[model samples]
Target: MTGGPKASRRVICAALAGAAALSATLFPGAAALAGPADKLRDSLSRGRSAEISAPPIARFVAQDGRVFVLDRTQPAPMLKFEDSPEVWVLSPSPAPRGDVIYKNDLGEPMLRATRLGGVTLFSRQRPAGEPVSLAGGGVPLRLGGLSPQALSERMLQASVRSGRAARRQVVFEAEATPASAALIADAAMVVSLAFVRLAGRDRDALGQVDSVRFSEGRRPSASLADGVLTIVVSPGHGLAGRPSSDRVAKAIRTAD
Candidate 1:
C-alpha cells in the first residue's frame, strides 16, 4: 500500500516536469513572433507624411555632354545650354496656365500646354525639313505662321488622339519609372504610366532601388550614374501642377 502511494507521487512529479519543459521550449518562439508584430504596429502608428518644398531649378545633361538649366521662376522658362537641341515645352500646371520646356536626346523641341479654357495642345517643331503631319480624332489645325499663343489655341481645337503618334502622350509615358512612382506617391499624386528604356544605356549601372515602388500611371525623372540609369518621383503638394502630360513629355525630351 505504501509503494502504491509513492508510485503515484513519482508519476505526478514526472507529469509536472514534462509540462514545464514543454512550456520552456515554446516560450522563445512565442516571444519572437510577438516582437516583430509589436514593432510593425509601432511603425504604423508613427507613419509620417511627405513634405513639399519650393520648386527648384533643375539641370539636365544630354548624351552629347551638353548641360541645360531650367529656372521655373522665369515668366517664360528657357533652356540655357550651348549647341543644345531645340527646346520643347512640355506640361504646364496650375490649370489653364503653366509651361515646361525640354529637349529630347535627339535635341528636338516638342511643346505641350493647356489654355485658359482647359484646352490641351501639343506642338513639335521638327528640323526644317522633317515631316510634320497633323491627324487625330479632331479636325487638324493649320500650324503654319502661328504664334505660340495662337498655335496653342488652334491645337486645342484639334481633337486629342491616343497612341504612340501623339507627341505629348508619348513623351509623358517615356520618362516614367519605378523610382518616380514612389515620388508621385509621396506627393499624393497618381498617374498612368508605361515602362520605357533608361535615357542613356540599356545596362543600368545605377544601384538597385530598395525603397521605391513603381506602379502603372506614375513616371520617374531622369538620372544617370556610372552608366546606370535611375529616375525618382515622389508625392507632395509642391509637386502639384496642371498638364502633367506635358510635364512628362518635357521630361522625356530632356532626358539624355
Candidate 2:
C-alpha cells in the first residue's frame, strides 16, 4: 500500500531517466553525453540512500548530458567533474522551495538541489544551469597520497606556474611530511586558485602576491600581509584542514 522514501527516490530517478531519454531524441547528439548518465543510472538501480534530508553521495547527469559527482561525506562537501582531477569544496546555502544551493569559494553557484532530489548545475559551460537527475550513490572523493619527494615536486610546479602568471617570484615555503603531503599538495593549488580569483577581480592584483607560506595549525585559515600569503592547515581537520581557495582569494582581496 505505501512505498516509503526508497520507493519515492526510485520513482524520481525513473522520471528523470525518462526526461533524459526524451531530450536525447528531441535534441540530436544529446546521447553523446549520456555515457556517464547511463553508468550512474545503472548504479542507482543497484542501491543508494533514498532520503532527501541527508542526500546520498551520487553522480548526477545534466540536461546537456554532462556528468559530475557530488560527495557529501567529506569534512567539507566536495564536487568533482567526470573529466577532472580537481575536487572543489562547496559551501551549502538555502534556496527557494526547500532546495539547497552549493557555492564555491567565490560565492558562485555550482549546484542547486530540490527537495525531491533533482539538481541544477551552473558552470561556464552552462551559466544558467542544466537540469540534473539522480544517477546513484558514488564513492567518496579522496585526495591521493603523495610521497615527500612527489609533494615537493608538485609544490615546485605549482609555484612555477603561479609565478609565471604573476610575472614575479611566487615562492612557496611548506613544511612537508607524509601525513601532510596531500594537504600541502592541495594547498599549492588552493593558493594558485586564489591568485586566479584575485586576477579575475583586478588584472593587476596578482602583482601584489609575492610568496605563499604553509604551516600546520589548530584550524584552517589564510591571511595576506605585506605581499605574502600565509595558509594555515590543520592536519586533524582532514579534508577541511586548509583554508579553501575562495578564502585564500578573499584574504588577498580584503588585504588589498
Candidate 3:
C-alpha cells in the first residue's frame, strides 16, 4: 500500500539524501546491514502490490504516486540487533492530488512539509472534496475556492474511483442527551442523499461510507473536523446495528 495524499505532495525534503545513500549514511557501521536473503525476505514481506524481488524505484521511490521509499530496508540499521525492529506501517491510503493549499500568507507558497521542531507536518489535512458537517445550526462550510456543486462533483467522482475523494466523513450531532442513534444515522443518510443530488451521480454513495462513529462533546453539538464528528447519545443507546428514523427510512426505501 502507498502513502496517502499528504505523503505524495510533501515536496520531498530537498536536503534529504537519496534512499540508498540515506540508508548507508544511517548504517555506516555495516554491522547492522542485512544480507541479500534478509533483504529479499523483507521486500517480499511487503504488500502484494510491490513487485517482489524487483529493483527499488530509483532512490526516491513512489508506490502508487505516494512516497514509499524510506532509507530503512524496512530501514536497515547500521548495527545488527538480536531481533529486527518492527516497522511502523501506517494505514495504507489512496493518495490525493493537488499541491499545497494554495496559500499566500508566506512570501511564497508554504512548503507542505515544514520544519516543525524535529518532525515534519505535511499540511495535508484537507483532501480534495473533503466532506464537512451537514449539521443545521453550525457555521457554513468553506470549500476553499470550490463551490458546493464542484465539491459534490469531486466527491462523487472520488466515490466511483478508489482514491481519497471517495472516503468522506458524514457527521451527526445532537444538542442534548437521549439523542437517537437513528437520528444520527438518518442525518448521515441525508448527507449521502445530498451528495448524490449535488453530483448527479448514482445513489450507490451510501455504500462508500464504512464505519459510522459517534461521540459526545461538552454541549449538544454536531460538527465535523479532523475527518471526525462529535455527537451526544445516551449511554445505553447503542446504534449502527439498526436502521434510522422512520421518516428517513421511508425516504431511503422510497428512493430505492
Candidate 4:
C-alpha cells in the first residue's frame, strides 16, 4: 500500500523534524567538534580498525552507504539509517550482551566483538550502491543517491526476492533542516533490517527496516507501498514501547 502524495509530504516533514531533534541530542558535546559535515569528514579519515578490547565509539560507512554510529556501551550498538549517524545506543552500566562485526564489501568478515561496553562508530562513506547482508534472514539493502523512483524499484525487487510482502510509503521531506538532510545524504547503503515485534500485534512493526537496529530512543513506525516499506525513527523523549510506537505512527501520519 503506497502512501498518497499528501501522506508522503507528511512523512517527509515529520522525518525532518525528528531528524533535527535527534541530531541535537546525539552530539550534545560536539559543539567543539565543528558541524556535522566537518565532524563526519574527520570521522571518515580515521578508518575502522580490527582492534577489539573495550568497545570504542567508532564510525564506518557500510557498503550500502549508511553511516553507522556504534556505541559500545550497550549490549549492542544502536543503529539508525539516514544521511548521517545521529542515533544513540543505550544500555545498562554493566553493558549489555551483543556483538559487533566488521566486514568488507564482499561479505568477508574482518573484526568481531562479543562484548561492547560503551563506544560509538561513525562512517565517512557517501551514498553508494552496495549490498550488505547480515546473519539470518536479512537482505542486503542498497544505499546511495537514488531517485525516489529508483529506490522504490530496488525495494520492490528486494521484497519479491525475499518473499515478504513489501510495503512502501512516502513519510515526508524537509529542505529547511540541514541536519536532517545531512543524515539522509550520508547514507550509502542499507546494511541490515532488525525486525522487532510489537506486543499484541503478531506482526513485527519493523520487519522491513533495512538497518540492523534503530536507535535506542526511537520506536518503529512505518508505511508500506508497492513492495517498499519506509520506517520512521524518532527520538524517545523518555517514552518507550507502545507510546514510542504511537509517536512514530503519528509522525508518519503528519509528515511533510
Candidate 5:
C-alpha cells in the first residue's frame, strides 16, 4: 500500500516472473510435451492452484474510511460494503503487471488487487478508484435461514412499500425456505428501491411493472420485462446471493 504505482508494478512483475520460473521447474517440459488435451488439463490445474493460494477471505479499509470484504471461497469472488446488506459477485480478469481486476455484471471494474495485497476500489464517487490497505481476514459470509412467518412478514412489508410508491398493486412471489428467505428479503429490498426510483423519476414510473418474482438459480440476476420483474438469486453464493439494490434499480430503469 505504501509503494508508488511504478514500484508496485515492478514488484508484481518480479513476483510473476518468479512464479513462472517455479512452475516451469516443477512441470519440466509441460508446455512442449503437452498435447491439446494435456495442455487443457495443465491449464486447469494451474488455475486451481492459483485459486487455492489466493486468500479465501480478506478485509480492507479504504482511505475514505469505508470497509469492504472480499470473499473468494466460492467459484466467483463476492464483495460486500460495510453496513450494507447487498453482496456483489464480481468476475475477475488478469490486469497488467500480474494484478487482478474484479468487475461487476455490467463489466465495470470494481476492484483491482495486486499480488502483494494492495487493493484499489472503484465507485461512482471515485471513478479512478482509491487505494485501500489490507485490514485483516474477515468473517466468511453465510446465509442464515429465517422463520417462515418472519419471511412472510418481511416480504409483505416490502411489497406494501413498493406498491404504495408505484401507485399500483405490486405482487411478490417466491418459494420460502430458510436459505431462500434470506434471498427473498434481499430481493424485496431491491424491488422497493427500484420502485422508489421509478416513482421519483415519473409519477407513474412503475405503472408498467405488475409483479416481481424471486427464485433461486445458479446465477444471480435481475430482469424486467412485460410488466414482470424477475430476480434470480443463487444459493451457492451464500450471503453473496443478494444483488446490490443500486445495480438492480439501474437495471430496472434501463429495461423499462
Candidate 6:
C-alpha cells in the first residue's frame, strides 16, 4: 500500500535526523568549546605560542616565559616552535590563575583584562636603543628594573621573607603577579647558547650529555665548543676543582 512506502520514508528521515543530532552533540565547533582567551591560555599552557590581536595591534606571546634559556639544552632531534614565538616573545607567562598583560614583537607590553571588564590598553612599540617606559602601558602594575645580579639578590631576599628558598630560579625584576616574571639586563631578549659537536660534529659530542647544570656558588653560564667547556661566573666565585670533577670529565668525554 502507499502507507507502507510513507512509513519507511518517515523511519529513514527520523534516523537521519537522529544521526545529525548525535553528530552535533559529539563534535561541537571550537567556538562552542572555548573562547578566544581560553584558547590562547590553553595554547600557552602547553608551552606554545599564541598571537593575540586587539585591533590595530597583534603580536606573538610565548605561553612559556623563561628568561634564562640554554639553546639546544635538550634537542629533540629537531625542535619545532609552531605555537611559541620565533624570537622569544619575552612576555609574562600566565600564572596558574589570574590575569596579566601580554608583551609584543618590539618588547612593548599591552594589557587585556577579559573577565570583569573587556578593555584593552595599547602602547607604541619601542624603537631599538630607545628607553622603554615600563609604566607607559595603561595597566596599573609596579614595574622594577634591575641588573641580573640585583634581581638575584631580590630573589634571595624574597625567599628569606617567605622562608622558602629555591636553589636556582630564572626570575625577572618586573612586577609579576603572585606567580611569574623577568627582564633582560641589556637587550629585551638575550639568547646565550653554544655550539656542541654532536656525532663527530659539535652537536654529536654535545648531544651525548644529558644536561648542563651550574653548581657554583656564583650563578655562572656555560658554553661548549670544539670539546672545550667554558664556565663564566662572577669574579671571586671559586672555580678550583670545578672543571676537574669526574662528572665534568665524563661530560667532556661524552661530548668528545
- Among these predictions, the greatest lDDT belongs to 2
lDDT of each: 0.32, 0.77, 0.30, 0.35, 0.76, 0.32
What lDDT tens digits, residue by residue, belong to model 2 across residues 1-256? 3669889999999999999889878986767677788866865665433323335588877788877888887656888878754678788887765577888866789988775566678988799888887777777877778888888888898898788767688999897677788988988887776666566566477777788888888888888889888888877666667777667767877785
TM-score of 3: 0.18
Cα lDDT of model 1 by residue, 117-198, tens digit = 1211222322322221222222111112324443333222221221112333211222333333323332212111211222
The 10-residue segment with the lowest total lDDT in model 4? 188-197
Q: What lDDT tens digits, residue by residue, belong to model 4 across residues 90-160?
A: 32222124444443222233334443222233232322223332312221222224355544454444333
In terms of lDDT, model 3 sits at: 0.30
TM-score of 5: 0.67
TM-score of 4: 0.23
Question: What's model 2's lDDT at 213?
Answer: 88
Comparison by TM-score, 1 against 6, better one? 1
Model 5 gets an lDDT of 0.76
Instruction: Estimate, for each residue in 107-202, the C-alpha lDDT of model 5 and write its tens digit.
Output: 889988775457788987799999887788987765567788887887898899899998889898887566688777867876686677668776
Identify the runs in model 4 with alpha carbons over 4 angstroms from their true place. Answer: 1-146, 164-219, 222-231, 235-256
Model 4, residue 126: distance off in Å is 34
Which lDDT value does model 4 have at 10? 97
State every prediction's TM-score relative to the real structure: 0.21, 0.68, 0.18, 0.23, 0.67, 0.18
User: lDDT at 187 for candidate 1?
Assistant: 20
| Residue 56 lDDT (model 2) | 54
Model 5: which ten-residue window has the lowest total lDDT? 45-54
lDDT of 6: 0.32
The Cα error of candidate 1 at residue 154, in Å, is 34
**TM-score for predicted model 2 compared with the true structure:** 0.68
Model 1: runs farther than 4 Å from truth? 1-108, 111-129, 138-196, 213-256
